[model samples]
Target chain A: MQRALTLAALALAIAFPMAAVPLDLDFYIGFASRVMIYAIAATSLNLILGYGGMVSFGHAAFFGTGAYVVAIAMTHGIDSLWVSWPLAMLVSGIVALGIGAISLRTRGVYFIMITLAFAQMMFFVFIGLKAYGGEEGLNMPHRSVIGLGLNLKNDATFYYVVLTVLVATLYLLRRLIDARFGRVVEAIRENEARMETIGFSTYRYKLTCFVIAGMVCGLAGALIANQTRYVNPNLMHWIVSGDMMIMIILGGLGYRFGGVLGAIVMLVLDEAISPYTTYSKIVIGFVLLAVVLFAPRGLAGLFDRKRVRAGGGHG
Target chain B: MNSATRMTEPVLEVRALCKRFGGLVATDQVSLDVRPGEVHALIGPNGAGKTTLVHQLSGTLPPDSGSILFRGDDVTHLAANARVLRGLVRSYQITSIFRQHSVLDNVALAVQARSGSSFRFWRPVRDESALFDEARAVLARVGLADRADVLAANLAHGEQRQLEVGLAVATRPAMLLLDEPMAGMGPEESERLIPLIDGLRKDVSILLIEHDMDAVFRLADRISVLVSGRVIATGTPDDIRANADVKRAYLGDELEAASGGEA
Candidate 1:
């Protein structure tokens, strides 16, 4: 049934160019593209935080490195999409690997603080970079394009591409989590010591997950760069890391579909609340706190048939 | 006893291992040997340092001073997990398992660890026939093949203990360190566990730590007694039973009262 739903979504996405929703307005497409990008980032964070039991708060460093990869490559006059996007991913993966190797050496509150510190350090490096826009930011002359004849400058065209990538990425993530690797990560989450005593090397597995997450989040950063045509130190801010954490918690920690719903709900909330008053921050904050306290399992807990049946048929 | 190289040599040899926590000495100069496929029981009273010895042998704690040789390799300083990978598996006194997962998933993880390469990110655990087959076989061996789909946390305490043993066995390790498998069990459960543990002696070497004297006497080929961080005695169950100092340590009056009260 999930496969069919995914297939239907894919079919609709493929036919979307032909059956355009008619919301080609720059504002609507832009909002959607940004949400899709953030979805990628949130999904990656959830892989480690929710499933693997590694509460890393420095995911923004990788997110920013991804953005920097594109900005740095373009600043050097390398406009080729092929060259920039892959390098962006590689650099982010390497950074995550290095940071994860060190930060994951500790556990509990120490783990969270270590990850946050590493991300803050990265943020500072970007602030210190007078060569790239320093405190302001950097902008790309043109968006990335495939070698094909299609122009990526078209807002509608790029929005659809972002959507396709989001869907495919989610599909790949689902596959990865259901595999033997996923089982082991869940085992670690459930009982790290038990897994270790059974002859499994846990640190290596966590590092591997950290790298995969970084690699995926980097791709999201590449998309974000193209969407805005800009890169800035703000991309690596502690607030951005907090945003990803909020998304994971609000959606549902361990639910595969929670990350996607989290991104969508957060985006929608931001868009809606900002118009009501300047007090939008108060409302978002309370809603987030409520979710963490009252509904920790999040939206997917409501949707899971197993959970529903087990939860006295509440669904 | 000098079957040095082949099957006769001990799989694990411990010598004068000591661990101290602040002013209290947890394990003091404990020494023992575990021959291959032999059930070696370490019996001691509360705070007698049996667990401290197990921790040192399992690599969870570093010995203040001493050495551990597993299969003739000096593994005294290896990390707990590294020691586990080297085939020293320990079962906790309080059953530590993945509570949310099905029993089959719990054991399958053990099999997956041994089969090498958990990097296959597309194959479902249930669909991995090789893992499922081995998991089922292990559950069967531990008398839990029927509860494969049941969540581990939801199991009765006895069944969870059985699964814990199954997990240690599924690793197919050269030695198992069982830390009081009968700790909280009722008589019916303890009765059930003894044969299962006795049956394990046919294949697996065990460093059995227990407070249940009868179970220890029934199951151990050889016995070591710990008294306040030190090995006070090492002998067969009969030798241990005949020792006057061992009786003094456990209290002869308490033993007589217990036997009188039970009868």
Candidate 2:
């Protein structure tokens, strides 16, 4: 039953842009693309925080790093999507490697604090870069050229692109979590001492998961930069990391596509509620409270009953 | 048969190991050895530093001044996982199986660790039938084959203890550091564990730290009595039973009762 629901959801997602085009709601296409991008970021965060049990609070650093990679490359007249996207992922992955290496040495709240500190350090560095608009942020001239007559500037095309990437990321992560490496990470989360005694170098495995999540989030960042045509230090803020964390909690931690579901719910709620009042955040805060108070497992938990059973044994 | 004949190269050797936490001496100049294929039991009262000594041997705790040799190699500085890779594994006194995973998954992970690089990100773990086959064999060995599909958290206390040993044994360790494998088990459960543990010595040496003196005496080829962070006696089961110093320092009437029950 749940598998059929997931397939139906995927079908609806793929047909969303087409349905929007016929309805003449072109602006919603861009909005949906933004949702897809955030979904990718949130999903990546879930890999470490939910699965690996490494609650990183500096994920926005990787996201912002990816955005800045694109912005900086554009400033240098290198506007190819292929070059900039891979470069963004590579830079974010390297930063994650350095940060994870240091942060993973400490655990629990200490790990969270260290990752936050590293991200704030990156934020301050971007703020101090006088050449890149500093605090105000930089603007992109246009979206990257994909070649082969594909125009990313077209909203419909861009939505499809974002959807493709989101679908691919979800599919890959699904396969990854069931793989041997994924099992090891989950085992480490369940019992680090037991994992070590069973011959797993958990530190190495955790660092690897951290790096992969960072790189995937970086891809989201690059897409966001293209969507907004802007890069700023605000993207690397600690609150942005908290927001992604909230999305995971709001959707359901450790659920395969919970991140996507969470991003959609959060973004749609923001879009709907923000027009009526300036206190959208306050309203959202209450919703989060309700979710936590009643459905402790998040929105995805309502759909999949097995999660409640699995979640019961968590230490 | 004789002391000299049994004195071949020991599989594990701890030389004058000492550890101090503030003013408390947890392990005080403890020295011991486990010969190949023998169940060398370390028996002690509560807070006797048996767990501390086991931690040091398993590479979890670093001793202040001592060395641990495994198969004649100095492994005092090796990390816990590295020591495990070298075929030295330990089980927890508290049951520590992966609670969320099925019994098969818990054992399969151990087999996966010994198989190859777990860095393979794409292939599904279920596709590897060899690991499941070996994991099933390990579960069967521990008499948990029937419960292989059950979540580890749902198992009874005795079953969980058995699964814990299954996890440790799946790694194919040359020496097993079992920390109270019979802890919290009823008499019947302990009875079941006795033969399971006794059968393990044919494949690997066991360094057992147990409070259950009956199980220790039944399984131990050599017994070491620890009192207040020190080894008070080391001998055969009969020698330990006859040793006055052991009785005076720690064993007391329990040894007499156990020996009488055995006779």
Candidate 3:
């Protein structure tokens, strides 16, 4: 049943852009692409926060860094997708290495606070970059050129790109969580002392996982920059980090693909409620409260009742 | 024991280890040794600093002033995991298996750690049949083979203790630091653990801190009685039983009860 649901979801994702045109709901193509991009970001956060048990509250630093890489490259007349995308991922991974090395030394609330502080520092740095439109943000005149007659400016084509990346990210994370490295991280999450006694340097594993997650989120940030054609300091805001965290919790903290489900639900709700009232956040907040109180395992838990009952529900 | 054999180098040596928390000295100049292939039990009264001493030996607690030598190497300053990698592994008094994972997975992780390639990121861990086989052998050794699929949290208290031993054994340690291996066991469970632990002496030396006097007396090749953060006696079981200082400090009543139970 679970496999069927996943397959159905995948089919829907692939078919949505094509279906949107004839259905006269073409705007949904770009909207769904945005959801997929956020899903990529949320999924990356889940790698560290859910699987590794590193509650990094400064993920936006990587996201904004990736976006800025694209924006800055565009400002310099470098429109190649291949160059900017890899550079974005590499730069964000390096940033994550520096931040994670220091932040992983502290644990629990201190770790959370430290990551947030680092992200805020990045936000301020970006805001102070006067050449890149400063606080107002930078605008890209055109989407990144792949140089193979492939146009990312087209909504349906771009939607396919985002969808492909999301699928690949999910696939990579699945392989990762089932790997030896994944087992060690999960073991560390369960019992760090025991993991150490059994011969694992948990700090090293966590730092590496942090860097991997940051690079993945950085890729998402690059995609978002192209989709929106804008990069801003607000992309690295603490509230954005909080939103990604909320998506993880709402989708299912440890469950693979929960982030995608969460991003879709959250983005859809945001779009739906915005037309009704400017206080859409109020509605979204109440819905989140309901989900937290009733489905502590997140929306994915609603599908796997047996797992929750068996006490093996963690993703 | 032959004099030459008795003088053989110790596998673990703790010399004048001391730890103080503010004004209180938790481990006050404690010294002990475990010769190769011998179960050297560290017995003490409550607050006798046995756990503190264990903490120092296991590298969890830094000593104010002391040194620990393992297999003729000074390892006092090494971190816990580094010590573990050097073939010194310890189990907790409270069972510390990976609670959310299956019993097999708990042991498998230990085996994986020792397998020298846990850094492999792309390969699925489940496909590693060698790790599973090794883990199964360890579980069978500890008599937990049947419970391998059960979650650690779902295991009986006795089974968790067995799993704890299995986890340590999976690491293939040269020396085992067992902290209360039978802390909450019934006579039946304790009976099962005795032979299981005694069986390990041919391969690994053990520095055991157990409150169960009967098991300690039965299993220990040499027993050290610790009272108020000091070793009052270190000798054979019969010698420790006859020591006046040991009787006065602690184990006075328990020794009598243990001897009576034995008879």
Candidate 4:
């Protein structure tokens, strides 16, 4: 039954933008695109936070770095999606490697603090660099050129691109979660000392997982930059990192669709409620509190029919 | 005891292992050896540093001064995982099985460690039938095949203990540092573990630190009594039972009880 529902959801997602272009509801296409981008970002956070048990509070460092890489690449005559997107991911992965190497040495709260410190350091570094518009940020010359004959400047076309990327990201994440790498990662999360005793070099696995998450998140950043046509230091702020973490927890940690569900719920709630009240954040806060109190497993747990085993993350 | 087996080199050799915390010396010049296929039991009272010695041997704790030779190679400075890769494994005194994984998965992960690099990111682990097959065989050896699918957290205390050993056994280690495998087990649980441990003697050497005197007397080929971070006696079960120093240190009351139960 859940499988059928998921298929219906996928069908709706695919058909919605097509129907929107005809009905002249093109504005929602861009909004839906934003949701997909955030979904990717949140899913990357989930990879480390939920599955690996690494509470990284500096995801925005990679995301913002990716955005900057794309924007800067455009200035240097590398505007093609193929080159810039992968470059963004590469740069973000390098950043995660540097940050994770240091951060992973410390665990629990220290890990959280160290990651945040690095991100804040990145934020400040960007803010100080006047060449890239500094504190005010830089605007993209235009949306990244796909060079694939698709008009990316159009909202509907861009929405389809983001949708495809989101689908691919989810598929990749699913493959990873089912793979031997995922098994080792989740087992390490469950018990690192035991994993070591059983002959696993846990630090290497965790660092690799962190790098992968960063690369995926970087892709989201590149897409978001194209969507907004701007890059700012605020993109790497600690608040954005907190926002990603909130989405993961609010959606459901360790569940397959938690990140996507969280991104959708959070963004939709913000969009739907903010117009009605200036104090929309207070309402959101209350809702989050209610979820934490009543739905300890987050929003995705509500849809699950099986009582997930006590220690096992969803497959 | 055959002269050929006695003349064979010890699988693990520890030389003057010492550790200090502030003013207290947790491990005081502790020296021991495990023959290639004998259960060498270490019995000690509370704070006797048996666990500390095991921790040092397993590479979990660094000794202030010591040398550990595994298969004649000095492994004192090797990391814990590296030591396990060299076939030196240890089980915890506390039950430390992965609580969220199934019994089979817990063992499968151990089997996965020695099979190959776990960096295979594309193929699903479910497709790796060899890992599960070996893990099932390990579970059966530990008498947990019936509970293969059960979550480890849901297992009874004794079953969890069994899984703990199962995990170590899966690594196919040449020597096992069992840090009180029967720490919290009931008499029946300890009884089941005795033959299981005895059965393992054919494959690996064991350095067992156990509080259960009955299990130790039944399983140990040689017994070392530790008191105040020092070896008070090292002898055969019969020799240890007759040793006055062993009784004076840690085994006085338990020695009587063990002998009575034996009779």
Report the CAPRI category for model 2. medium
Per-model CA lDDT versus the true structure: 0.85, 0.92, 0.90, 0.91
What is candidate 2's lDDT per residue for A1-315, written digit by digit as tens? Answer: 978987898898788888997899878999989999999999999999988889899999999999999999999999999899999999999999999999999988999999999999999999999999999999999998889899999988888888889989988998999899899998898889889999999999999999999999999999999999999999999989998998998998888777987888888999999999988888879889999889888888888765434563343
TM for candidate 2 is 0.97
List pairs with backbone clashes in candidate 3: A254-A315
Give the per-residue Cα lDDT of candidate 3 at A100: 97
Per-residue lDDT of B1-263 in model 3, one digit per residue for the tens? 56675459898999998888888888888888999999999998888888888888888888899899998899999998889899999998978878898999999999998797777888998889999999999999999989988888888999999999999999999999999999899989999999999999999999999989989989999999888788888999999988898898788877777678878
Error of 2 at B95 (Å): 0.8
Q: Specify the CAPRI tier of model 3.
A: medium
What number of clashing residue pairs does each candidate have, in the order they appear?
1, 0, 1, 0
> Per-residue alpha-carbon lDDT of model 4 for B183-247, expressed as tens digits?
88988899889889999999899999998887888899999988888887899999998898877
Off-target runs (Cα >4 Å) in candidate 1 are A1-26, A307-315, B1-4, B251-254
Model 1 score (lDDT)? 0.85
Tens digit of per-residue lDDT, candidate 3, span A184-278: 98888878889999888888899999999999999999999999999899999999999999898889887897798789888899999898899
Report model 1's TM-score to 2 decimal places.
0.95
Q: Model 2: runs farther than 4 Å from truth?
A: A307-315, B1-7, B256-263
Measured against the true two-chain complex, the DockQ scores of the candidates, in the order shown, are 0.60, 0.73, 0.59, 0.61
Order of the predicted models by DockQ, top scorer first? 2, 4, 1, 3
Residue-pair clash count for candidate 2: 0
Instruction: Give the worst 10-residue stretch by lDDT in candidate 2 chain A.
Output: A306-315
How well docked is model 1, in DockQ terms?
A: 0.60
